[model samples]
Target: MLFCDPSMLPCYRSVQCIGYLSVKIHRFMLYTFTFIYSLGV
Candidate 1:
């Protein structure tokens, strides 16, 4: 169960957005590393 008061809504939304972007950046880094490794082999 998640509950956010009106005053806290903006802060909560920003946290969620930051978390989503971090996950995406992590996946991109993983792909980049693998591609470089394959080229090096």
Candidate 2:
């Protein structure tokens, strides 16, 4: 079993953080598109 080193934790964490941020951004874009489409009616 490979134990994660403290130094590597930040790098791993940053990648996870970016993934989470991108998910949020993706949702925001979808939400905005839906909202705009609804306004067209």
Q: For candidate 1, lDDT tens digit of each residue in 1-41?
A: 03333555687867766777788899999999999999999
Question: What lDDT is reached at residue 19 by model 1?
Answer: 77
The clash number for model 1 is 0
The alpha-carbon deviation from the true structure for residue 36 of candidate 2, after best TM-score superposition, in angstroms, is: 0.6
Backbone clashes under 3 angstroms, per model: 0, 0
Clashes of 2: 0
For model 1, what is the error of residue 5's alpha carbon versus the real structure, in angstroms, after optimal superposition? Answer: 17
**Runs of candidate 1 exceeding 4 Å displacement:** 1-8
Off by over 4 Å in 2: 1-8
Clashing pairs for predicted structure model 2, backbone only: none
Sliding window of 10 residues with minimal summed lDDT for model 2 = 1-10
